[model samples]
Target: MAEPTERDPLIQKPTVFTDADSASRGEPATKQRLGPLEISASNRRGILAGIWLGTFLGVLTLVPTMMPSISSEFQKFHLASWLGTAYLLATCTFTPLYGRLSNVMGRRGANHTAIAFTAIGTVMCGLSRNMESLIAARFIAGIGGGGLFTTATIIVSDMYTLRNRGLVHGVASCFNGLGMGLGGPFGGLITDLLGWRAAFLLQIPLFVFALILIQYNIRYVTPGKSKGTMEMLKRIDYLGSLTLLVALGSPLFFLSARYNESLPWSEARVITPLILAIVFILGFLGVELFLAKEPVLAPGMLQQKVPVLVGASNFLVGACNFSVTYFYPMWFQVVMLQSASTAGMHLMPNSVSMSIGSLFAGWMMHSTGRYKRINLIFGIFPFIGTTLISRLREDSGPIHSWLSIIPLGFGNAVALHTMLIALLAHLPESHMAVGTGFAQLFRGIGQVLGVAISSAIFQSRLDAELRKRFHVPDAENLIRQIRRNSNYIRELPSEQQAYARDSYALALKTVYIFAACLTISAYLVRLPIPDQDLDKAHARQRAQAEARRNSTAEVATTNAVASTSTGSGLPTPEYPARSPTETETEPEEPAA
Candidate 1:
């Protein structure tokens, strides 16, 4: 926040470059009490923001859950997941855009904007009659709900002090899990008794509650006015945002729809979108380097040692994140032979485990002020478990699958939230939002691509296997045959059923194998980050920052003395008060 003056000293401020797990750090007592806006942040509003964010996510999850219901209502089973995919894409795509917007608009304002978007979208979804109308409404809601999750992290980081950031992040994390944890039951009950449409309507009252809390309990603070719209626009890196969105969303959009379409992956429908996304990303990176003064995703942010290592690792975990979130339900439905609601019920533990992991991570970081040790131990658990799950046969029931998923869920909890703490700890303060936004965006991109790539592998392998043995052109036909006559294939079908089931099994296994590889990759990425020296550089910068602050104060004192020189005929000199950034860093022992 400080600007260098003409005679300012050359002492450098300490710039921490934590990339992933840094958000878990806790804030100090004093700083947590106030902020740049001069509003007391360690108040009820902070908790309100977390609740609103989690509720919106909960509401969004309902869209996914209700999609199948809506599909059955409209007799459009094909469009079921699109209800979710629409929101997921929007949330993942626009989070960075909201981050940049919030940087200009103020954190409190971003919260309001997110709530508005989510509320409106949820209401619209409830009212929609057709697939087209439903998808459009979900898309709008997705935009609003998308930024809520990412910005919530920023709000916690901005509002709370560094030392206490972990606690806030952990507490904040509980809300999302709570929403999902509750949503499965709540949505099911709502849909079962009231109808699927009623599930979307429930979010409206929650939004009203959140809005009332914000207007009264939350302080409304504006951003600095001096930057101006044009300067903000110049820094937005629109090309980069577009590039990132396309690169991420393209794969998802294609894969989800491709199988349903005749041409599928072979058509320009898929190929064209894929190529355009890649081209745009390459172009955006080029523009980011040469043109933008303050690019949205700065080259420095990417090239920084901590970020690069953490980011690569994040990509791996991101794959698991998508797989776990998207396919795990399907696994429960198919493997566990449970209804959709029942599958979600079974998934309750994963959400609980994630919440627990986040809290534990925050507490550990707060107490010990170190992340690598716990992170390393927990991060590997899921990788090992998920790998084991991939080896299980199709007939493997709940017990066999749980052997992998229990640890899969547990290990993921430790790895992701821990990485978040490490990241927040390492990123420079000036670029905190950008760093967080990019982390979220690329993480989303990794997820989209992971699902698409993994899905492609599954579909292709399954298609080949089915066609070779059953003489079916694709897996779809095989599934249709099974659905049409349960025992028809079983009757003639020793070889035929074996081929179809084997292909299906292979496809699922392939997905798991890819996920396991990603976990291993993430594990390796985290390993390098720990041994890599970061603390020493931060220490030097902290010392320099202190010297600069002292020097500035002394200069102001000398100016005051000069002003009192009565013999000199000159007027009293006016010295400017030092800005917050120009002032001394907080007196905390560690930078956090």
Candidate 2:
């Protein structure tokens, strides 16, 4: 046969890893060895737990604060928007694929692939020679970065029982919050001290260490028989993946072009892509529902009411969270006239609040075994915070700025932790990876939408305000220059500087109001999620485990008796059989 093409799937061979899932199902584990130390199934989870903080910190170094510096170096501040957009787009495109890919490659293989891609992309980013190359490099890194969090969540679900999963997730999210919290200041400081390229170059060592950790901890048990490469490749849903990409990318292109090109909504440049996006989305739905076998999105995954609502809520949460993250620094740096490093410092309150809120939400769920009330109570924070932030003036104080950001951070973190558990609780164990992947996909798209929408609004408002305020003979050219490079605001007369700052402050108010509306919508969607009793679910799992152990021991005793009787030429001894209450219980699927 001819060799596989580039488009052919790249799934790993069907070798069993013999993880805790199989051991729980009573399947005999295959012995594996590399050298002196033997790898055990029970200890596999320690791999990620040991390195969770470094893992997120390495990937989530948000560099929005460095945009001015990076743009200045490239001499194209107008195109700086693509820096964040490209990363979010690539992440959104590939995140769902990793979920299905993990099932075929095993988590260990999938994780290594993600890390390797990230390392390569990070180096490429550091070495980039122009704006386009940097954007391309960020896209590549995002492909890997997206999977890091998705796979970590899947592994966490596998490692813990539902009884304590909340706390475990909370701890994991706390590390994520730390990474988000620290990444800004760290990136800004690096940019200030050594330049922005060092920010990307410095992360390479952490990823290298992560790979060593995975290699030593996760051991694979070879399978008795494996399928051919072509057979496994044919099982992947290539059409669905491509169609989904188009469905998401087309609209993004429309929104981005509309702003970057300064085109009207009715212009063919914007209208054509919008129409194409709708058609492709419809095509994607049909492919998932009928054409693909073992769809990237499993059947009824979002067809159920709970999953649909959860996915929608996550989308809005993503919008609310990312909108603030991307623009909050801009508020400090442009309007308040702080240095990049100082602006990043101002982000500390938001990030710290997220860490505290995640832990609190986790503790509540672990203690009470409930999530509905927790979600409702926390969901209100984003709306309140956004509404308050909308009231900011050009002369707002540090206390006002810090106080406005805290509610957004705290509420969004709680919503993220609770929503994941809620989504998993409704899905079957087999669908956990895909379900979680879809959740990430939704949130990633929301990040892109949030930033894109906010950018468009900011640009339009800034242009209008500049025209209205400036009475110079060359006002239009001056406005364009100021819009392209925020640094130009400093070059203007002191009176013009005040006007420019006021324009930014007013435009941002509109953006915050838009985010506030999304938070309200998220709260409404969350109200109807059905509550599952986490404690009862924990009890059921324990009962089933005990049944399996008793059944295994009984079989061992019967085998010994028969062997003895045959050796002595005596009749086998009679033994009492288990009663209905003592009989083996039908095994239930593991809780997420």
Residue 1 C-alpha lDDT in model 1 = 28
- Poorest lDDT segment (10 consecutive residues) of candidate 1: 583-592
Q: What are the models' TM-scores?
A: 0.76, 0.83
Runs in model 2 deviating more than 4 A are 1-45, 50-55, 220-230, 264-268, 538-592
- Give the whole-model CA lDDT for all candidates, comma-separated: 0.60, 0.72
Go through the candidates in order and give the clash count of each.
Answer: 32, 0
Writing each residue's lDDT as its tens digit, candidate 1 over 456-505 gives 56555655555566645675665544422322334444666565556556
Question: Per-residue lDDT tens digits of candidate 2, residues 1-592?
Answer: 2444455333212222234344323333364333101335445555655347335743465577888778778776666767877777777777776776565565666677778777788899899999999989988887787777887776666566775778878888877887777778887888889999998898887887888777666553321112222444566778977887788778767876687557788898799989999999999889888888756555566668887888888889888887777777888888888787877876777878888888998999999998889988887998888888888876677688777888988898888888888877766554567788878878887877887777777777767787789888888787777777887788889999998888888777778888899888988988999888887765655565466546754664565455434643443323222211110111121211
Query: What does the lDDT come to for candidate 1?
Result: 0.60
